[model samples]
Target: MDDKDRELMDRYVYQVVRRLPKDQRDDVSMELKELIGDMAEEKGSVREALVALGDPAEFAKKYAGESRYLIGPLYIDTYWKVLKIALMCVLIAVFSITLAQGIIERYEPGLFTDLGSIIGFFTHIFSTTLSSTISSALGVFATVTIVFMVMEHYKVDLDEGKNVVWTIDDLSKKEPGSKANVTGMSAEWTPDRLTPVPGKKAMLPRGDSIADIVFSVIFGAILIFTPYILGVVWFIEDDEIGKGVMTIPIFNLDKWNLILPVFLISLLAGLTDAILRVIIGRYNLKVMVSSIVSGFIQIVCWIIALKVLPIWNPNFGNELRRFIDSEFGAMDFATYFDPVRFSNIILVLAIFGLAVEMIVTVVRTLRYGLDEGKAR
Candidate 1:
């Protein structure tokens, strides 16, 4: 081979080697150089050597395959997997805390209230410090381990002889139906189309199932107690122990009117998101559909609660006097309908629904747009 050809081959190999993990880069470079040199000796020319080594693009692919535990082609290009796992951890922590608090209030009653100081004390400990560290460590470890394990299971090692048995360019140059052409074509095309991507078979833990309920209950208790502990400490610091003790009941007791709506919305959103993800397998569709559906449901519920509930009376004085003097005396008929108060309540709820829907719609649209842009 000519000096120029040799230099080109070395440079090409170096470029491929540079892409490999630092630990393996130098060794891979030396190995590739040796392999190319041996091929050149047998072929007797630089052009022949290059042909045997295969297309530079194809060669680079083969080089990557040498790593038995490569996460992905774009592993270095992006940290999306890391980000996703981190987000999941935060979600778990939040869910844990919320669920624990709810359960404690339900079953333990005054226990949570009495331990307000403990809850207050631990709120900062769990939310800000302990939860953050634990979640981060678990997220990173789990993400990395899962990615690498899946990659290895798929036999994505670059150095493996099976991956680079032949090249596409080499196959195209050969006559159709030739043994070399067939083998090369099969090797280059079949792996991607036939073999499912690593991690595709693995099942992610869903927060909707019985398992989630169990986890939430167990973790929720811990989180609820954390806040009360903190509250006690707060009271001690403020020199208002009596007020703090009284505040425990209000703090720990779950207000069904408030908690129910939020829980329903969140649960519905999560289910909708999961369903959309399964249907579309795209971020844009999942986010948009989930947001819209959840928002719509929330608005409908608000409307019903505002319009259907008979809790206010507009003309209390006149209606009460008439009822008192009527044949059906002492009946509380006027108390049933309060046009002024009812209208005000309905208006407030309607406005709230409208605002929520608008916010959700805008957010979903933006998320969809961003995802599409990324795909493009």
Candidate 2:
């Protein structure tokens, strides 16, 4: 057969296998491909071989070996997979929100001075976050399980309609004397309608997308609620009052009023990328475009916040210097180091990191677009 015929066969196999459970997809794909090859060889026409297989949905149902239960064997594996994804997402969200709230409520200047307070602070937040996460997890588990059970019990095919039953008549309909439309199945069921099988390397792991969601929420929360956490802390020796703690904030508090919106935009961009990644489930042109857009927005926002705006605390260098000199005796701090320049360096590094991420996404998508489970 020609390349076009081979492509058609692959598409037909993809249609059948993709409807099966995730763990079964690869094995079924290989089996279906081999079966098609054998059938085509016997029939002398790939198209005829596919027609003998009947509707892909019908073929998949037979191959799936479905069983009737609260959650049938046909859907149990997929139900578990969905449950895990939902639970992880809820866990990340609850933990990040809980930690952010804790930071906002408990974080103060020199709060880290005492090792005991540090331990206590973490202990309290961990306990609170754990309890919250567990509660949220239970709710997520119940919701996902119920939804899957209902779908399974009803034999609902989401790709079709709710409780859809395609009869022989549905498959037999055809225009009178129309040679091209001989079968009951619609012409739309042809291999041309099949989606390209996503390459193995191109597949976007749900865990990675979920991780992006978690990090975006966490970093955004840190930026919005506790920007002062990223700062320098020191202690002062007071002859009468004993050792006192001090802090020099890294960012200009007033400038945060302007920088925050830009940061929010970046955060939204990251979330959009992550959500798209999860939905698409693979590296493709669309996913690459999203990654680039998100990375660009983040890089631009960082540049604006770090370089164009006076986001860096104006007196960070001076205040830190005074604290250092007073505590450690006379010493040249500014001559040796500069906080503003250091922040600029960090911005440069961040930009580099973001750029690399975009490039990697593009390269991975292109490199794997054609692999298409051949190695598997």
Candidate 3:
């Protein structure tokens, strides 16, 4: 009837309904509100109505019915949540180790000189890593599932002794959110414990993050192990024959070694960004900050790779000139292509691309995190 009474009634209804499954929450909430209102009218006060209903937790358990599985409904939510996190970590660790082993075993000096060799190299590594990861993944899933099942059977609480049994007083006070207070698994369930449903823009695609991880590993490997594989292929005109194909290495190995650290730092930053995206599964201020930092580091690496370090082969021009002169008389290779100018152009393009990515990340963060009020 009064504002305070109305507030108490709403809080009581929320406590009961929030314990139900997502599909049942809305229907049960409407039913609970109507029931509470009728009871309150008869009882002369909302407090009296709530007391007659008994503890919201126990009332919800009755509605939830009995469990038919090893893990009851009470522990099912937490079991799945913990299981997913554990499996993800296991997969990441397995995949990383397998990939590293394959790469190290296959990699050798001047191993990937051509496109075919490069493709084969990566294909081998990918196939080997996939094969190794599958068995490990199965084992991890089984182990995690068994652990959770045992916990459920034993009536184990993740909170241990921290959370006491729910009481009527809990309905009157809001508790701060804590991971230890998982719904159904602990006695700290409150309306505030419910997470906001993520908007479309807030969600990060797992596929994209996975692709980023694979690409970053491969690209970083290329930078460290096979920089010379990236090259310019040209044709020299020949009088006797039609033409001869020549391949010239793009990056100078000597100079590349010097700037390798900078390139690796950039790769590390990018990998961190991808890992965070996969773990969080949503775009927020933290993910936005990571993206910005990753972009900045990559831009710096590109500048160093293309400008500060003499990574490009200085002898490329003369080498092309010698090959052309042997057949077509005399030619100035600089007139056709200047590696320095090309490097500058690439640096500019790389910076532009990174800038665009950072802007998009910031915009998504604002739209999903700020506008939707779901920053977490």
Candidate 4:
């Protein structure tokens, strides 16, 4: 063979064998090279032989099976369907809000008058859109995964009794000239009805999956990011503790250093779910376990923030009083809005929510490890 043919054959072999596991690579590479050489002899050219073998990636897939698993066999298909829908909804909602806010916030006296300003304006819009999309997608992924994890754990009958028992009599009826078509529409056996024997694949409807994913992402994002945003607002204009450029928002918690990391851990957990959803596309045993860890982290953080640590900034009270006297606001308004009382109410609600989530998650791990429910 010419040097060029040898080089081309080597490249093709490398591409295919590189995707195999390390243990299998050497054996597969030798086998593929010998097979390709034989095919090239028949095909008359190395290029033609490689083309007949088809795409390197596809050939690798045929040999390799699933190279990477985000969701396991039981959970991936549903995860994928749900994720696509959630992503679509998130994209629409995020871009709409981001575009509107970007235009409103970045408008300036000379923004449209110069080339530089126009470039900056578009850049701002693009950055905001991208960030919002990523944030929303992550939020959606976490929500879908957690919900599916719970459902998987419980072995919720996704498609209850989708398959019916078959009989030898039915098979015998399909023999030549037996014609056992039973739909009444068929000219064979005029059975009143027909039931399809469902396959093992989960029967989750795409629309339902999509809706579930969209809702989960939106709600989860709100819960995770609200505190982060508040913390950011608290530190935006002031480097000092307990001080901000604007009047301290009544909703902000004090001691950012203490609360921030806890919040980040929880957020990262949600992000883990998002990445898994994108990778695996289903709720399974592994996803459920990961979620259990994420949930526990959030519950601990919430418990501390609610029952032990102070959630509202004490500085907000001071700021409110100052604002009241400076503006037409009532002086007594600040006194009426008690941060302690406000925090207690929030604590009660948060704990209750966490308790519900914990129960469902724990129950799921106990029940379904990795069983493929009739409905994925």
- Give all candidates' CA lDDT scores: 0.46, 0.71, 0.69, 0.57
Candidate 3 C-alpha lDDT tens digits along 1-376: 8999889988987888787779999899889888988999999888999999999988988887764257876566655654675466556766876685576556655555788879998999989989878987788678878875776666665444332221111211221233223234466555645446667777888888777776776677567655654675554455676444446776776766587788899888888777667655677655688799889888888887787788777787776677677657876644365877899888888899889988988998887754322236
Flag regions of model 3 displaced more than 4 Å.
1-189, 233-247, 323-335, 371-376
TM-score, structure 4 vs. true: 0.45
TM-score of each: 0.30, 0.53, 0.48, 0.45
User: Poorest 10 consecutive residues of model 2 by lDDT?
Assistant: 167-176
Better lDDT candidate (2, 3): 2
Give the worst 10-residue stretch by lDDT in candidate 4.
161-170
Tell me the tens digit of each residue's lDDT in model 4 across 1-376.
7999999989998999898779988899899889989999999988999999999989988896653444455555555655665568677657666675566556654457889889998999999988988897788889878765654555443323121111111222232122223211445443322322223232213354345444444444444444333321211223364332232444454465576566566555555544443333333343456556766776677667756755667676666566666555666844566766776787678667756754654565445423332223
Off by over 4 Å in 2: 1-90, 93-187, 234-246, 333-340, 370-376
What's the C-alpha lDDT at position 184 in model 2? 26
Report the CA-based lDDT of candidate 4 relative to the real structure.
Answer: 0.57
lDDT of 2 by residue, 1-376 (tens): 8998899998998899887889999988988888888999999989999999989988988877754256876566656655765677668877878885675556655778999999988898888888988998899888888887877767765434232221111111221122222222464544343345555676778787888877876677677766776687655556686654456788888778998888789888887778667655667555687799889898888887777877778787787777778777768844344656876898989889888889989999888743432333
Question: Any idea how many clashes model 4 has?
Answer: 7
* Clashes by residue pair, model 3: none
**Per-candidate RMSD vs. true structure?**
18.8, 19.2, 18.9, 12.9
Candidate 1 lDDT over 58-100, as tens digits, reads: 6666766646335544232223433453345445665556544
- Segments of candidate 4 deviating more than 4 angstroms: 1-76, 85-127, 130-247, 251-254, 261-303, 333-335, 349-376
